[model samples]
Target: MIKRILLVTRGCAPDEFVPAWRAAMGAAVTAPPDVRPSRVTAGIVLDEVTPEPRHDAVGQEWFDDEEHLSRYESWLASPASAAVDELFGRAVERDATDIVVTGEHVLRGAPWFERRWRDGGEGLKHMALATRAAGLTQAEFFDRWRNRAGLVGAVPIPEVARGQAYLQNHPLPKAAGDWPYDAVNEVYFDDLDDLRERIAWFAENLAGNEDDLVRESWFVAVREEVLWPEATSAGEGLLPGRPGGRGTS
Candidate 1:
C-alpha cells in the first residue's frame, strides 16, 4: 500500500476552510461519480496545532499500489481538478510512501473528531520525520525499530494515547520532490506539556542508545482529523466510559 501525505496552507481562515474542505471530502466519498479513485482505501486530515512555514493542515491517503496512485493522480488532474484547485488554492506540499512498520500499543478512546481539534481539547499530535544513520542497512534499521517499539510500549506514559512508526519503502516520485527522510514517527498526547515530557524521556532513554539509529529528526504538533472507514472499527474501545478509555486528565 502507498500512503500520500499532504501539507496544505489555506488562503482563508479555519472557520471558512474547514467546513468547505469537509463538504468537498463528503462529496468525494458519498456523492455520485465518485471523485475519489477506487484504489483509495483510507485517508485522514490533520490541522497543525503549532504553525510551521506556510502549512496549516496535513492530509493522508492510503492506496492499493503505484498503479492505483497513478490513476488517482490522473483523476485529480482531470475530473476533480477544478474543485480541488478552488478549495485549496495553489500552495500545497505532499509526499508519498509505503508503510514498512507500524505499532499502536495504546489505543485512543474516541475516534478522532474535528471539533476536539478546533476547540483545542484533544491535546497535540506529534509527527516526526527522520533519516537513518549512514552505513545502516534497511534490514538493520527495521530490526532496531522493531526492538525499540517494545520499549516504547513498556514505558507506559499515561499522557500518550496512540503512536505509529513508518519507514519508506523506496524513493518517492519526483512530482512531490525529493524524499528527505526514510522514516516517519507519530504520537498523540493530551497536551503540549505531555508531548514535551515524552520527548525528554525518549532523549534520556531511546536516543542515548549506542545504535545511533536516527540521523535527523523534525517534530511538529498537529490536531488530527481522520477520515476513512477503518476509523470506526478502531474506535470500538474508545467510548468515554470504556475500560482503558481516553483519560480526561
Candidate 2:
C-alpha cells in the first residue's frame, strides 16, 4: 500500500477548521472502490507544545499502490474533486503545511489491540519528526534505523508492549531537497499513560542509539478522529470493523 500524509499548521481555528477539512477530504476522495483509499483519518493536534509544533493536524490516506494513488490523485485534480477541497483552505496554513509520500516499515504490529480508550479506538498518537545524526547520509541513516530489527530478537521493537502499533515512515527523496526530516514515525497507544511509558522506554533503552542516529526529533501528539467509512469502528467489541488509523484492527 502507498501512504500519503499531510501535516498542517492551522491558520483557521480548530473548531472551524476540523469539520471543514474532514468534509472537504471526504468529498475529494470519491474514486472507484478499487482506487479509493483504504484508510483515511484526521489526527487533530492534541496538546500545546514547544517550537509550536509545525503541524496542528495530520491528514493521512492509504491506497493499494502507486498506480492506485496516481489514479486517485488524477481524479483529485478534476474540477469536481477540486471543488470538494475548496473549503479546506485557510484552515491549513500554506507555509507550514507539508505533504509527504513515505515508505513504511512496521516494527511491532498487532492484530488484537486491547481497548483501553473510551471513545472507540480513538487514542493517543505520537509522531516524531526525526532528523539524521551528524555526518550520516540519508541512506546510512535508513540502514542503521531499520537494520536493528535483527538485534532486537523476536519482538518487533522494545516499546511494543506499551504501544499498540509502532511504525517507521521514511520519506522518499526529492531532487529539490525540500523535506527536512529523516523519518516520520508513528505510535498509537491505548492511552496517554501508555504513551508515556513508551517514551520513557525509548529514553532509557535506546537513547544512545537514538542519539547516534537522530540529531533532532520534533514530537507531536494527536487525538485521531476517523472521518470516513461510517461503520461500527475498528478493534474487537468497539464497533463492528477493519481499522484505518483510528479506524479498525
Question: Evaluated with lDDT, which candidate comes out highest?
Answer: 2
User: Candidate 1's residue-wise lDDT over 154-175, tens digit each?
Assistant: 4543334333322233324354
| TM-score for each predicted model, relative to the true structure | 0.55, 0.75
- Candidate 2 has what TM-score? 0.75
Worst 10 residues of 2 by lDDT: 238-247
Which sections of candidate 2 miss by over 4 Å? 48-51, 113-121, 149-161, 199-209, 230-249
Clashing pairs in 2: 232-239, 234-248, 243-248, 243-249, 244-248
lDDT of each: 0.46, 0.64
Candidate with best TM-score: 2
* Per-prediction tally of clashes: 1, 5
lDDT of 1: 0.46
**Cα RMSD, each candidate:** 9.6, 6.1
